[model samples]
Target: MRKALALAATLGTLAMTRALMRDRHVPLPTALPGRRETLSAPQVGTVAYYASPEGSGRPILLIHSINAAASAYETRPLYLHYRENRPVYALDLPGFGFSDRSRRRYTPRLMADAIHAVAAEIRARHGGETIDAIALSLSCSYLAKACLARPADYATIGLISPTGFDGRLSGEGPPDGHRGREILRDVLDRPLIGPLLFSGLASKVSIRFFLEKTFGATKIDEGLLDYAYATAHQPGAEHAPYCFIAGHLFPTDSTLLYDRLKLPVWMVHGQRGDFVDYRLAPRFAERPNWRIDSLPTGALPQFERLRAVTDCYDGFLASIRPSSPRG
Candidate 1:
């Protein structure tokens, strides 16, 4: 009886110590850019975004992946490059980055709605018009659905290392099954535990290890690690990894949405991309309007070879003139 009491006391002390440590460094929830515009979405909540007004013609919206470390700024390689010549906007999706995270279930539909809402806000600010959309990894699912739902709202669509192909193919089976579902529920549903696990796993050491292993590159930048760590530490951002692991953000029938798409579509995948099923691109490219660009790098091929990736995109953009030529 005495030993049991002592063990309990020790556990209690450890819990208190952890709680105190967590309180010691309460992280700031938001990270704003040098310049940004705030926009509100009904169900998804307010999103802090960056846009360039100097560019002409239709705007380009860059959507980052849905991950614990996701952020609009992390996708700067693409946005910063495109923003100079084209009106560009990068969004921190709900439950990720600086956006709101009140919703219990982070469904693909909810994310798609958030994308649509941001586009609407953009149109409202700069006359009634649709913008071209580019989405990466998990976000590609949401953007694809949004474009399908409102065909006229997007001038062109680009998917980079997109998901949903797993469900489309027979061998791939269901994208989320028992294990994936359990992981999702446990991660996102648990409050304190979820945040603790996120912080623990998203340490600089772990992130660097992941980047090196996944990208097959030895050179890991400290600035990128700091940015990812800072973004993951943000309030509610930790939940994104859980949602992604749980497969809540992954579109089940993403191929159906692709088949329904009416606009010009471009898909890019890295030969060594860790997060994508590169083999599936051939099937997607079978469609007349869809074109695929395979790169030599990994999932973040754009970052690995920023100049080459941007040059390819620039060429693609040049090939297509706006349906209504921009004056």
Candidate 2:
């Protein structure tokens, strides 16, 4: 009788596990208020973005961070705030959002090129107007790479709660060298355990847990939470997250890339959260082209202190005189 009870319990647990692992085909709602469009980028196909190109002056390009449930919603505050002041555009990077989530190694180059493609499209539409690009969290590196590759395409760039200042990553390796562990990457790509692993990570509770760490507070934006959960449940949602966890999404020489940037840069970071290490930032802060500001809220400060974030960023932009797009 005891053995039968043990067998019954084992079967029940397996049944529950199977149920959780089942992929739910759900409609992914747009993260912002605008018409969604796509760009056929090389290497990374069908990049989706939200556009409100009605406002005047130079266009602004927004990029969101990378993680399990990341999307344009990560930049929603900045997008919505800037839409009325100027033309605002937000992109979904290679793996996470409405972009290509196929089974492939999502690299930093692929992500950066997606930014470039979108910027090129924007320039084509607005008489080759130079853009002011801004990004959040880990995305700072990719935007920096894009800016470095095509400095003339951008007027200035903004980074909020960016990665690369942390002591653990030196980011001084050879070109395109990633911090991904081969063994771990292979393990994550395995058949049997891979799906189950991603299922657990993409769970609503799991996303909220990580988001809380990022916000550095118990209270987080509920809309973001809902969108994150829904997007995470969509088809091919787990592909990019596996690469992210295995560290394939990050390049080894991230800091070196930032140090090489010559364009006017605005960086705003939070004092409270899982990512707050700007010790190396003083090096750039001493330079005339860099402006670093610290906020009281967590990593995504725009949500908690939107006015402060916008004001600081606006001040930075106002400081830079407008230049001819082709000059």
RMSD of 1: 4.1
Instruction: Itemize residue pairs with steric clashes in candidate 1.
Output: 273-299
Per-residue accuracy of model 2 over 1-327 as CA lDDT, tens digit each? 999999998897778656755664667888999879998966878999999999999999999999988999989989999998899999999876788888888889888989999999999989999999999988899998888888889889999998887787648788767777768878978764677887888788998998899899999998888888888887788788888888888889889988898778999999987877777888788877789999989999999999999999999988875542221
Give the alpha carbon lDDT tens digit for every residue of 1-327 in model 1: 999999998897678647734632446433333357667867777776777756878888888876656777557778777767767788888876667755466777778888988888777766877777889876786787788777767777888777666534312333222123755567556655665666666777777877775566777555566677777655455565776667666666666666567677878877763555655566767765666787888777667888878777767767775563221
User: Against the true structure, whose lDDT is highest?
Assistant: 2
Off by over 4 Å in 1: 2-34, 166-188, 191-193, 321-327
- Residue pairs clashing in model 2 are 171-253
Residue 98, model 2: lDDT of 82
Estimate every model's Cα lDDT from 0 to 1. 0.69, 0.86
TM-score of each: 0.84, 0.92
